[model samples]
Target: MTAVLSRGRSDAPVRSVPGRPAPRRRPTVAPTWFLLPALVVYALVVLYPSLAGSVLAFTDRSGFDPGEWVGLANFEKLLRDDAARAALTNTVAVAVVITVVQTTLGLLLALALNSAIRARNLMRTLFFAPMMLSPIIVGLLWQYIYTPGGPLDSTLEGLGLGFLTRSWLGSDGALWAIVASIIWHHVGIVMAIYLAGLQSIPPELTEAAQVDGAGAVRRFWYVTRPLLGQSTTIVIALTLTASFKLFDQMFVMTGGGPGVSTQTLSLVMYQQAFVYGEYGYGTAIALVLTMIVAAVVFVQLSITRRGEHQV
Candidate 1:
């Protein structure tokens, strides 16, 4: 009986020793070969085309014949081109204005809807509904709204504010009109980002701040704002990039028009490449735009990441 009991005890699994951690199983890793198919497709589609197009930037190709290499001629011409310079200026201005105004308005809207209020859910849905619509649709809708004697002007005239009504898409205000429409279309996305950030924050933190004699403004400034650093970074990066590459809506509404008043870099590139068949010049412009976007985004990420760490 003693020998049988001892053998059974010896066969039992050993328990972990007190105060010692049990050994952890190594996680199973997928083989790198699993990514080979995707890598092959990406190289064929994206990498090959990008590399080929970039090479064309140095040549004087006109979409038909394989033209000779122009070295830095295209870039030099771009520097001296008045239209290109004006487009660059307008693009930068529009991007900055949209980023600032949209971000501010989105934050405000997020704050308002985040609070416990009647119809907040319905209001959020309504505001975000525009985002679901295609940009072309939004452009067409706003185009009609901005037309003289259209709904906007009619409403203003009915309200006895007829003096305020003018050609919204006129040269004097066409750029701004496009900017407003872009903001209205995209601000809801920014609001959604902020709302997600707000929800992630611990309610205890804000409650404690309130109990410690912090007013609404102070609490938001010190506690709530700092916690939203990540969301703000994401929102700004997205808005900045999107604004820089603005093409579709602007193309639909103004066609870079009222005499280039709202011409963006994208519009210029499109016109040069598709309309005029200046393939090489258009490719150069695209390369420059890509570099600008990459550099700006890098600096922005650095600054925002530093802010996050400080928070």
Candidate 2:
């Protein structure tokens, strides 16, 4: 017993072997500390500007000076103006179309890619390439495509479908065309998100359903869809927010032109502030837009959370 006790005491410490050094300990930064940089930047860039805009909404400040106090006047004008009303309606319609179309197409693509296919990695890269391009650049490229007698029209003519070709940017269909371009650029990201979700799902679940005599559609509906609740929430939320902030494509392609047809809230906000020099009114418009976006995100998240719990 005394010899065992002596041996235990001798081996108590982790002594390094001769000719070999101790293993190096990895250094890890605290999670809170990692967030410091982003928090500071957001405070300076987004938070401060938003607060200043809110305060300026009350006063009619035209960029240079703090002008007269006008309580609810800006909001009053915003409510009664026909242009503002039209802009709001267009904004809502475009957002809905973009959210639905983008999510559906993206989900389909994700499902297709998740299956065994030839050159799947190459296809993924090609699809995701457009998403990596600048929004402005995308707007610019689509501008040429939608231009009168441009590539789109040429392609239609070549296909003997010239009757379907028209001035996309110059007509009533301009907004939807812009939405299509946005979907093209962003649907890749949505697909990537869904692919991640599909990958995360356990193979055994699908296999079990198959063994139980469940058909393909039934298995997907009963097992896959419910499991993809979180991915659906993410795709919908991101696309909804992006739709509301619909500016770059509409701005570059149509310029809210042929009238106020394509004038989204963000586009109108820019025109009101920079083009017309109505800074206070523009700030007011921006504040309202921000609130609407925030409300949408909150409602979407809440609904999705409730659905997740129910599922």
Candidate 2: where are CA atoms >4 Å away?
A: 1-41, 309-311
For each candidate, what is the lDDT? 0.90, 0.87
- In Å, residue 23's CA in model 1 sits off its true spot by 13
Candidate 1 has an lDDT of: 0.90
The 10-residue segment with the lowest total lDDT in model 2: 1-10
lDDT of 1 by residue, 3-111 (tens): 2112234344444455666534444366677988999999999999998889988999997978999999999989998999999999899989998999999999999
Off by over 4 Å in 1: 1-31, 309-311
Error at 49, model 2, angstroms:
2.8
Residue 22 CA displacement from its true place in model 2, Å: 38
Across 187-268, the per-residue lDDT of candidate 2 in tens digits comes to 9999999999899899999999999999999988998888888999999999999899888888888889879999888988
Alpha-carbon RMSD to native, per candidate: 6.0, 7.5
